[model samples]
Target: MDSASVYTRCQDRLLDLAAELTAEQLATPVPALPDWTVLQTYAHLAGVCADVVGGLVPPSDDTTTARQVAERAGDDLDAVCAEWRSQAPALLEVFARETRARYRLPALDVWHHENDIRGALGLGAQTLDADQLAHFTVGGLARGWAPDVPGVRVVAVDTGQEWLLGERADLELRAEAFELARAVTGRRSVRQIAAMDWKGDPSAVAHRLPTLPAPEVDLAV
Candidate 1:
C-alpha cells in the first residue's frame, strides 16, 4: 500500500477534527493516553513528523516524546495543528521515497492516534480505510515485530481477514479490525483484550505484544 498517502489522509482528517474542537475539548484528557490532553497528543504527532523531516529518528522513547510535547507546551491547538501540517509535505516525501517497512509505521501511528483523539472527544469511530489498517497489522506490526507468542491466529471479524502471527495457530483473537489493531498497539488494556472474542487464552499473548504493552486501566473509549 502507499503508506505516504495513508499518512496524509489520516493526518488531514485529524487536523480537520482538531479545527472543530473547543478550547475545553482540546484540553480534555485522552483516555487512551490519560496523561496527555488532546492538544498534547497533536504536539507529539507534529513533533514526530518534524523529527523525521529533520533527519532525526522520530521519538518513540518516553523521554524524547515528553520533550517533544514539552517543547510545544505553550502552543495552542491551532498552532500545534499548524506545526503538524507544516511537516506533512516533507514527511510525505520521505515516506514515499522509502521501500523499508518502517516507513509505514508513521501512518499507523497517525491512524491510531486519530482514533484515540476521536474517542477522547466522545466522537464515534471515524470512517477510515479498514484495508489500510489490515495491511499495517498484517505487515508492519504483527509480522514486522514478530511477537513471541506461541501462536496467534488473528481474525478480523469486521473485514474477514485472518493472519497467523507466530510459528503456529494455537490461539485465535477475534475482534473488529480497528480493535485488533488497537489491542496490539497499546491502546487496549489486558482487561479489554479479555473482553474480546478469544479462543484459548488471551493471556498467552496479551503482554507479549511487540509494541507498547497494554495499559492497566481499561480506556473508556
Candidate 2:
C-alpha cells in the first residue's frame, strides 16, 4: 500500500478502537501513560489529527506561532475530537489525491500518535503490523527532532530489522523500532530502553527525539 493508504488504515483502526470504548473506559487511567487516561488519549489523537488537517488544506506560508495554533485548536477536548472526526473524511480525500511530499504534516505524527493510543491501551500486540512498523521507521527519521543530528543506524536486536538514518558514521543503536520510537518521542525513557538491552549513546541521541505536546483532558463529558 502507498503512504496515504497506510495513513488511512491507521486512522480508521484508531477510530474503530475508540468507538469500542465506553465513556467510563475512556476515562480509565492508562497505567503505561500515567499522565493520561484513555479519554485524554482520544482527545490528543483527535486534536493532533485536526492540527495536521488544518496544516494540509492550505499549506502555511509561515509557521504559525505555537500559542496561536493552540488558540485555533481551542481548549475544549470534546470539541476538538468531534471536529477532527467530522473533518477526517475531507482530509483523507485530499490525502488520497496528493503525493506524500504535498502532505502538510509529517507522516510520522499520524503513525506515532496512533501507536501512542494503542500503547496506552496495551493494544500494540494487536494493532501494529509489519508494514506499519516499516512506515513508522521511515516516518520517524523523516520527522526527527533535530535537522543537525547526524543520521543514525537502527538495528532491532530481536528481529534483526535494520534501517539507516542520517550518516553511516553516526552512532548505531540496537533496539526494536517501537521501543526506539517511544524513547525518541519521550514516552519511554532512555533507562527504560537500556533495561531491555538497547545499545546507544542515550544522552546524545535522546535529545534528538521528537517531543509530544502535553495531553489535554476531556472535560466536556
| Candidate number with greatest TM-score | 1
Which candidate should be chosen as best, given lDDT against the real structure?
A: 1
Query: Cα deviation in Å at residue 67, candidate 1?
Result: 1.6
Model 1 score (lDDT):
0.78
Question: Per-residue lDDT tens digits of candidate 2, residues 110-211?
Answer: 565566556655564333443445445445664554556766666766566676666553666676656655554455544453344434554565445434
Give candidate 2's TM-score: 0.59
Instruction: Write down the lDDT that model 2 would get.
Output: 0.54
* Candidate 1 lDDT, 127-182, residue by residue in tens: 46766676576545556535554677888887888888777888888888777777
**What's model 1's lDDT at 12?**
81
Local lDDT at 194 for model 2: 38
Model 2, residue 114: C-alpha shift (Å) = 3.5
**For model 2, where is the 10-residue window of minimal lDDT?**
212-221
